[model samples]
Target: MTGLAVVGVADDTDGPVVHLVTADERARHCPDCGARARRSKDRRVTRPRDLSVGSRRPRLVWAKRRWRCDELTCRRRSFTESVPPVPPRKRLTTRLRAAAGAAVADQGRTVVQAARDYALSWPVVAGAFTSHARAVLPAQPEPVQALGIDEIRRGRPRWIPDEATGIWQTAVDRWHVGFVDLSGKQGLLGQVGGRTAQAVIAWLADRDQAWRDAVQYVAIDMCTIFKSAIRRVLPQATLVVDHFHLVQLANQTLTEVRRRVTVTHRGRRGRKGNREWELRNRLTRSAARMRGEHVDALLDELSNLPRVIGAPITVAWNAKEDLLDLLATARTGNRSAICCTGSTADAPTPTFPNCSA
Candidate 1:
């Protein structure tokens, strides 16, 4: 931008195209000898990409000059004119790359989405994001009081031919593990290639001893790989099952129980006209969110069903509600549990199975 000057503007099918050229230069000095070059080598023009002007993208055409440093004693001979925004040999401007990176890293746009919006290749956008991440991330992650680790299916998996093995193999892993700073303002702390214990260990091993020691709790789903890795790396940190997974497990168990009861009593799966099917969604909803009349109606309907058909479902529903109630105490740092299994009407007593912090 410093050395660049707008020559003119023209209309295009997409938007306005801006023409740019280098400003009149003061005497060019040789890099090594500090002497000006009297002879010109050649001149060339390059087209570099920039950020979009509006809804549509504008084209950029730049005319640059190549200079010959005529100082005899100096080792440097020829160099190309460059500006801060549009550097030499770069196809995209600095601002373009920075904007692409920010779209993905800050605005939560995916790499493919940013690349499509910028009319660039996926690799270019991904490289820009890597640069942006390095600019933002610390050399060592800040010490976290509580850490959360989870697995995500990043994108559709691809299979490509493995040249050396002469066989087809997965090009990239679909599953990735993301680490988060649960106890502080920083959101996503790091990500790794796989959801394996080794991957988690590798990331944790990179941290300093003091940073690892500061982690008081590690919150994760019911994943043994993560649990094992935490035990090996940060043995002092307590393992806590996150609330989302607990609620998910409760819902899954309740659904399974309802399906089995429906088949046993009705001699078939739930259909649209079936009362059991009609109440399926209502049963999963939390009691606190339901109106008083709806709650009473739901209770009356379930109670009127055949005792054998309704009893098991009623137990499962009650268990889910009780578990939700226990989880409410988690904010106070209280560990509580209720038996979410078995048909016993009594609430489960507190018990934690394995040795944990």
Candidate 2:
């Protein structure tokens, strides 16, 4: 007999069922009284589901041994024998339960899907996955140095009927703020309800003094509310604007310039056949990323247009390109590059000829 002794065997409609008992049996000690008992109290049998053994799902009917404490001086009662494969009051073996947990957590499948895959109940698989997650998750969060804050839209704008005023009131909150610990193994710390300074302040104030002191920097978008909140709560932490929002600002500037230039020259809104309108994306693209011949040809085309259309578009496009160059130079930590770029940008350029009637 291996760890399992086959007491009997039977054939079921699904597969072969085996009745098993513990193979290794020696002197048993009462857990509470520390007394060895040779006398038998009672016997019981349980059917526990096990993992598939060679393409056949094993159903085990386990005959268990129960013992009574022999010491009268100790406040002891009868206890049941524990087995390695199955725990008390559980219908699935440990290995089977672990398989269900792995199906849900590791494979990224839903609990319902895992239940169907493992031939177990939904609650059973879900509970096992939850327990596995709790056991594997870090006992305590690692310290965070740099934090990131951002907001995401939750749902559409909604209106609720107001009975007292007989009018519909618009819902207020449509955004959620996520706080992330950039320096920690787990990026997300928590999420708050609103994007207001008060909400952020309250969350930071809840942390202990040491945690607040440990924070070295905070990265956020160009939201004044978040900046103000960090200033009030974590005053020592350096506030840095995130890169995505900086790119968004550049895009907004390009869009405004394009719209203004379009309306000024074309005397109407931009549409097809408008050269400036068609090259909006090309105008925003970095010069290095664009094909040398194509970008030069496009700029040459702009220069050949009328002074009013060409001048404004050329200036804005040059500014966008120069901005990218300046950012790249700054990343390399070269002071000379910064000074040279600044000088080049400030230098005077040939002005557009007056086309006044």
Candidate 3:
């Protein structure tokens, strides 16, 4: 824009049409001091394709000039001249750099495509975008109460070679997300939680002390590592096991009991074993397929099973109900409780019993 002026357009023997621009000045500046100076040595014209201005193709036509600094305190003389809109060391224009950044941020396009579109070299486009994103994106804020921790996988390709035959297999991996509360709202905290404990701990360590102190309660699944991380990070906070995890555990226990009962019933009627097994399978599958009110009704019917094999089923059902009761109790009284032995403990630091059902 400064030195070059577009003159005319001509079609090349190759496909693309090219625009010609001419450089006018021999002015130069000191690279170290950024002080204006006259050209001490003149170089050949370096014409590089620049960003498009409107519909017209733009070209950068300029000479690289070497200038000598007059200041004695300066480290050395003989520095390259600076371009106005383009970065000091790079050949691409400021507008092209911006377009490349937008491509990465907004369109989720690869750096290579962005570079090609802007007529810029890969390094120039990449460095500018990276630098700009680092400057503009805000730092992670601290969590106040109810932080959630999770993990995710980064950069790993979807496919990997199997160890046995060296055949490519699709891999399923995860990365961790740690949510922090900046506003002290319990509900607003920790939406991102993943499988890794170390990632959760590191995220907690990044938060400020004031935010840690403001936390009164933390709701998490029964992940031992997550619980341990919470204990280390926020020792004073109340820990409440999430209801969803408890329900899942109860459902699993119920399903197991159903499987055992179905197996025993089929054994008793030994004649049509295959047909009986298939029927039982259909029933089990139907129970699994049941949703919402139907699931609740099935659970209720399971709860009414006679005291023979139904003891475990009843226990699992009651456990689920008790879990819901605890959640309601906490919500009504605004007090947290630790679940232990199919019951809620009132103690601040309650010991949880090893009860699967």
Candidate 4:
């Protein structure tokens, strides 16, 4: 519509067709001789695909004039008029291709998905997205300070026959490790094939020495493979575990202790009406969310059970809550001016009854 004016509209079985012409009579000069083209040979109509109008498909019909370049010394013959929105000899309009590209890139749609939505082919949509990405995205990556490494589960494992040995082996690497720039504007760095040390090492090795040296701190889950790889590649970087994984480890430990205590004391699985079972959910609840009286009751009941039965559960629950409290401190201490319990490094180590600190 930038340089085109709609002359007429017609209905078709598939959708609507719009007849368009150039809005202005701009002077056209011969490309080689630089002489104004005054004579017109003939006119032809070309149809270009467009985005859907309303809910129906739309097509643009353009009547272009073929101008004969009358430059006697020039080697050019004739040329046709084209606009920015509708390029010459292109089946799809420029606006339509740009729209499809934006749909695939900005909207996070797959190539096939965008193709189906726009009634276009798969390769066309893919090309559109790739072009859009290259045009808008930066050529070089930004420097990173803190890096985070984590694994994501892909999907159900599949079995395929091995070429060398005819036996089919189950796909063991169902996980992909993703690296992220924690401190910079760049979000995700990249993802590698497997969750092994070799995959992590390979990705780290691909980066230049300056990139490895710039990475001062690395955050990762309790993944030994990642730990070993970073140690070998970026030895100067400090490896720290995220609070979410720390909380997960604490919860898992608490659950194991609770299950073991229940089986040993009650001689069966935990069920309703049992004091421990009833308090299961509340046991992990943060101290802020716990009701004072219910918590006091829990303490009174659990404290009375013999040391052999109640001691383990109480110790495990206390440890979990303590870690949660420490995590809360570290998380908020940087934001708030007031620091809770001081730095954990200088904090007193937890000492249990009759156990050396």
Candidate 5:
């Protein structure tokens, strides 16, 4: 390539460089007008970085010429020759711009870093990154049938008071197979108001009717806002309450059991040291002991319950058993059985047998 002498050469400690000559046969035509006006009014030379020629860093030596138009009725009297393989009215070469774009888009590097690496201005680097991202980023996906909504706390900054804190909410649309972060905002739903029902509805409204009809099930916690949104948008879909929220209700009941047991035991005249400690220990061991394969441990613990706190212990034990029964009923795939346990009073009687599920 060095044998083809279309331009001059400059060698430095950093790299080998080549310059473009405007006096060549190919350089005579005006780039803007595409006219063969060889009479040059003015000339300017610019050196731009190019893709590496073999092992050596190559440079595009540009020779810009302002040539007078020979046509009488042309609006402009003169125009510059257009450079090949480079963007018009831009100094940086296409190869350098592309490298800068890759650095920003693929690597998440800042425009400042990209500019410094490519030896370009900040705006040039930013423009390249933006252009590349616009070209490559995937279009927003179609909506799914099922959706999940939840809120997350946003803590106060060190500069702000704790009471003035806010939160960033998010919603997820659960497809039968997988889930998508359909926060209704661009680029994966990372928005401040993303958790609102309005935002979710807005997102669904943008999708096609086929996508809307494809939804068969919508699973979410019992948030009224979310429920309202789901009913409004997916009237035909079945709304399934998330299992985790049901479990949480049962957990809350267990907490109430602890409180009630503590109160009832303290009312006894002689209950102070051993008796109180035993009751507290029993309450703590309830769920932990029953978890997974520790059912035998739980049974053994329940069997050895102290006679002094037997009544409260029996109440908690019965509640846990009822809860398990309810869970079994829900998981049996019978819609009628599940529907029968819907009311707060009828379902898990939040007292002696708190079947929370």
Candidate 6:
């Protein structure tokens, strides 16, 4: 089918074997120098793996030629023949490698899974995907307008014992810093080893000066290290703090409030059948997400509970709702009246103790 002459075909222990050779033998040009070589140095045999044909996989054994380059000026050496379906220094055919790469990259199969499907070793499949990625994907991109910085934990924390004191020091094994380009379609820029200022600055420093100058905005969390690094390298760029962390902070504050209210009112940790414990999750949920009927039902349920139990929980719930409202209104670019002004015209503040600012 590939236009190569089929010298022989036989059944082997490994399935069907197809012996192939080049149909037309012609003089080949020297790879280093363009000069043609007419002399044959030797002939070699290569067995490259091909794709499976239906349920049976055919092994391709190719008879290859070697040519002697007679050019005096050129670094003269004997070069081997390169034919269709098999490139130089490769044991697998082009189609076989491409199939493995597509399984891993395009079809989202793991390396082990792709290896099993292709009937190849795991390392072979993984190397094919790596080569395909390098060939097809762009190495460097134009400067990103908006970059987002985040970190991911590598593994669970470990405790190292002190030799003398016998006290264990807690340590996190590995952390990676991920940079994302928010300006264009290419989602992830790359990742660095550690989540420190030095690691980020070193990655940025590798880019050209023009690329660095083109960066306009950076979005990061409340980490001072990330902010400090960005301020030094891209001073002109605007730093926008990520709002997701703020919402997380608000949720944590609500939990703390719930715990404190539980301790003060009941003189113990919350347990089953407590109204505050029952409605804990509902309390942190935003007012905008709650239906009118649901909110009314919850408020009625709270009003009927003991005043000491219901009052503190209501305050925390209202504060959480207010924070969500503030964030939502800010997102839409619309102004809403602040609820915490110390005046009769303003609404009463929800008594969350730790969330003043």
Could you give candidate 1's per-residue lDDT for residues 30-148 as a string of tens digits? 54576766777888888888887678777888876778987677788987777668766799999999999999999999999999999999999999999998998888878888888
- What does each candidate score in C-alpha RMSD? 6.4, 10.5, 8.7, 9.2, 10.4, 8.0
Please report, in order, the local distance difference test score of every candidate based on alpha carbons.
Answer: 0.82, 0.76, 0.57, 0.78, 0.59, 0.78
lDDT of 5 by residue, 1-357 (tens): 221246567887667667765444554555545567847799766665666555667666776677787766556678765545554576666767888899998998898987876667898888888788777765545454344455554443223234546543323322112233332233232223345677667766766778778776666677786678878988997766655676567656665665565566665343455443444444444354356656555445545656545455556666765665555654444434543434553433211111122
In terms of TM-score, the best-performing candidate is: 1
- Prediction 1 global C-alpha lDDT: 0.82
Q: Give candidate 6's whole-model lDDT.
A: 0.78
User: Model 1, residue 228: what's the lDDT?
Assistant: 94
**In every candidate, how many clashes are there?**
0, 0, 17, 0, 4, 0
- TM match of model 5 to true structure: 0.47
List the candidates ranked by TM-score, beginning with the highest. 1, 6, 4, 2, 3, 5
Per-residue error for 284 in candidate 5, Å, reads 8.8
Q: Model 4, 1-357: lDDT tens per residue?
A: 787899999999988888998774552555457677899988989988988878998777888788899877888899777677876678888778888899988898888888999989988887887788778876645668788899999876677889999999766568899988777657777777677899999988888899889887788888899999999999998787887888888888887888788889889988986777777787777766778898788777778766766788889888887777666554443424333564655543221121110
Best by lDDT: 1
The predicted structure with the larger TM-score, 4 or 6, is 6
> Which 10-residue window of candidate 5 scores lowest in summed lDDT?
348-357
The total of clashing pairs for model 6 equals: 0
| TM-score (all chains, Cα) for each model | 0.70, 0.59, 0.55, 0.65, 0.47, 0.68
Candidate 2: list runs displaced more than 4 Å. 1-10, 16-54, 58-131, 151-207, 333-337, 340-357
Q: After superposition, how far is residue 81 of candidate 6 from its true place, in Å?
A: 7.5
Clashing pairs in 5: 20-61, 31-81, 31-82, 145-215
How well is each residue in 320-352 modelled by candidate 2, as lDDT tens digits?
776676566534544354545354655432211
Instruction: For candidate 2, give the lDDT of residue 224.
Output: 95
Per-residue error (Å), model 3, residue 57 = 5.4
Which ranges of candidate 4 are over 4 A from the true structure?
1-11, 16-50, 53-97, 104-116, 120-131, 156-174, 334-357
